[model samples]
Target: MWIIFGILTLIMTLLNLYMYNAGKNYHIFMVLSLFLMALTLCDQYQMIASWSLAGDWSAIADVAPTLSMILWIFVIGSFVVNVIPLLLSYRKNR
Candidate 1:
């Protein structure tokens, strides 16, 4: 199930990147895809950690908490970047 989520997230990210490169208006989608990917990474990390601590390495779990944390940081940064422009434009119009 988690693997499926990861794969979907990866696909979304790639699609967003392609759209971005193609000069399409998909900044919001890019940000959202990144956020989802970050969440999936965090979930995968937790699953891996639990399995490792229980000494159950054969369960085929994915880990890497540090990487997940980094991704979360990126997500937050990207969210801010995505929102600030909209806020500025709104304020300017008002």
Candidate 2:
């Protein structure tokens, strides 16, 4: 679930970038990016909760934190990549 959401988020982010470049209305993509990001976070938390319930201490300890960190980085990096170009274009237009 988390992996699926993560991949969707990446694809949406790329679509956002493409929309920006094409001078299309990318606001819907922006909204979808944020929505997908939230879904991904929820999926990650659910995964951690399942591991905790199953008493998988090793996975909880060894994987969860690091995976969360990587997820955050990927989300932020993709978001910035999508938004910065739009910002630049706005300033360029002005």
Candidate 3:
């Protein structure tokens, strides 16, 4: 599973880079894909961490705080960075 997710992340990252350089409007898709990949990795990490803890996971909620934080931050940030501009421009253009 980890290997699969790692490969997926790599593929998405590569796709993002290619899309970026292709001079196409791909930021939205690229960011979404990257964010999803990141979240998937974070979830995988949490699963591993949970298994490692095994009924003794101290402060389970605290484990991999950064993972969730980073996931949501990137998700929301990407939306703000990409969508807001599109919206503003759309409104302005209209």
Q: Who wins the TM-score comparison? A: 2
Instruction: Summarize candidate 1's per-residue lDDT along 22-94 as a digit string, tens digits.
Output: 6576566656666676676677668777788899866733335455576667557555644554465567679
lDDT by residue (tens digit), candidate 2, 1-94 = 8788878888888888888889888878877877888898888888889999999999899997789789879778877877786788889999
lDDT of the candidates, in the order given: 0.62, 0.83, 0.59
Tell me the TM-score of each prediction against the true structure. 0.46, 0.86, 0.43
Top-scoring candidate (lDDT): 2
TM-score of model 3 vs. true structure: 0.43
Error of 3 at 24 (Å): 0.8
The residue-by-residue lDDT of candidate 3 on 1-94, one tens digit each, is: 6456545655655565565457556565556655666676676677857766686555555655665686566556544544544465577679
> Residue 68 lDDT in model 2?
73
Which run of 10 residues does model 1 get worst, by summed lDDT? 59-68
| lDDT-sorted candidate list, best first | 2, 1, 3
Residue pairs in collision within model 2: none
